[model samples]
Target: MTAPASSRLGIYCMLGGMFLISINDMLIKSLSGGYSLHQLVLMRSLVGVFFTLFMLKMEGGFAVLRTGRPGLHLLRALLIVFANTSLYAAIVSMPLATATALYFASPLFVTLLSIPVLGERVGPRRFAAVGIGFAGVLTMMAPQLAGKGDIGWVMILPVMAAAGYACMAVLTRKLGATSRASALAIHLQVAFVIVSLGVWAVAGDGRFAEGTDNESVRFLLRAWVWPETGDLAAIAGLGVMSAVVGYLMTQAYRLSRASTVAPFEYVLLLYSLFWGWSIFGEWPEPTVFIGAAVIIAAGVYVFMREDRVKATRRT
Candidate 1:
């Protein structure tokens, strides 16, 4: 059946969320040259906590934070932390194209996990759409893929991150209406704060980072440094974007079937291309257009298939 009005809203939320994710990633990568992963996440999430509070006030107030599912909230927070940090490390250590193409496998994991985790049905066609979308992702980054011979082990980082993210999305669907979006976002930020502090306690002195030539490890073990005025502002911007993104992502999964919204994530690659051309001034190759066309076609097929399902129900 065609998705309900809520599901349509969910699709919009997913699209908005993915757009923010791409922008946030660009910011993260650009900033990584000077700061540690934990510092950026910690600072960004701290700012996000304030944004979350304002969102809560705007949405209704602290009373709306009531939820019987605290344990699930905690689990979701941890999964997101795992996913976020893993992807961050990957981005810092390697080219963005290689890291992203592997991480884009998330929608596939979401679709497969939804079957047993959320008890959602997947038709053959929907499965193909997700696969084709990922294929397009590969097409966009084929050169990077071809050159990563020795770094094959490193590729698993993003895939592991994808699984963590998939579990988090599926759980968001299972949580349904038990919690508000701000509550979810705040809990996640709090978790980030706690974990960031823990990492700080262990590695804050930069002792482990000594002689660490591996860039990813250095990003982890590096001592926290005070940010200058300019960089601090950029980190704060991440907080605002992250707050809005957290709400949109939670709303997306909470309001609709996971399968219905999962494929729309392919839309992120399109935004990546836009950001590349506009912000970073990278010229796109022709294959980028071919890959983009495939991605768009897959998304359109998924939308049409949903309409067909709606029509079959009416008959």
Candidate 2:
């Protein structure tokens, strides 16, 4: 079906949410040097949980927590937790652009996996898009595959995460009106809390290893530093912005189809590129750009094809 006039707004909202999410990832990566991924995930989840609960309460009473598909909700939450945790690991081990590029493969994975999982029809166009997307990935991986840095295996994490994320998106749509978005977000946070705590407990030793005095260490310490009055205001601004962005994102999915909205998520790649350059002075090499371009183009084609199909239906 063609999207409703109201659903059009969700496009912009989702894009904006993707932007905020990218910034969040960039910030975590910028600080990934001194602090472990476990710490970052734990803190982000803690902050997210605080706001998610409030929003859930305001939107609906605690009854929002009750849903027919509680098992599916928990399963979706676990998938997201796993996806994000793997993504964090990939970010710590790989280049920002590369990691983001690989993760962007989720849409293509969704298209491919839908055939089996959802019994969705797939035509030649989608098949081509999925194929080209993988080619783009191979383009990006060529260097790592042949070069000295053999940490190439880390790339699998984001790919796996992307697959899992796509599954979560599929499940989200299946959920229909059985649960509110706010409640779903809360469940995700709950799962994240359990996973993050587990990681911190097991691998927490020496992550914030002492006496390093590196830029990463400085960044972490700066997080704790009591900012001057101006800096304090800026910090407060970001926190509020984070919550606002988070809410808008929740609303986006609540209002639109996952396939329709998920493609615009590629916008995060542009944001990742910006932060990668600004914060780390790490511009991806030419091959990386070539690969990223192909991947993005394939994604765009898929999204466009979906639009065409929807438009034809409207006609």
Provide the TM-score for each candidate, comma-separated.
0.77, 0.80
Candidate 1 per-residue C-alpha lDDT over 190-241 given as tens digits, one digit per residue, 9 for 90 to 100: 9999999998988888899898677777777788899988887789989999
- Residue 214, candidate 1: alpha-carbon lDDT: 74
Task: Give the Cα-based TM-score of candidate 2 against the true structure.
Answer: 0.80
Cα deviation at 137, candidate 2, in Å, is: 1.1
Clashing pairs in 2: none
After superposition, candidate 1 runs with Cα above 4 Å error: 1-17, 127-150, 247-264, 274-315
| Maximum-TM-score candidate | 2
The residue-by-residue lDDT of candidate 2 on 3-117, one tens digit each, is 7965787888988888877777776675565455555555666666778779888978688898878889988999888787678667655667778988888878877767776
Window of ten residues with lowest summed lDDT in model 1: 147-156
User: Where does model 2 exceed 4 Å of error?
Assistant: 1-11, 148-151, 206-243, 253-263, 310-315
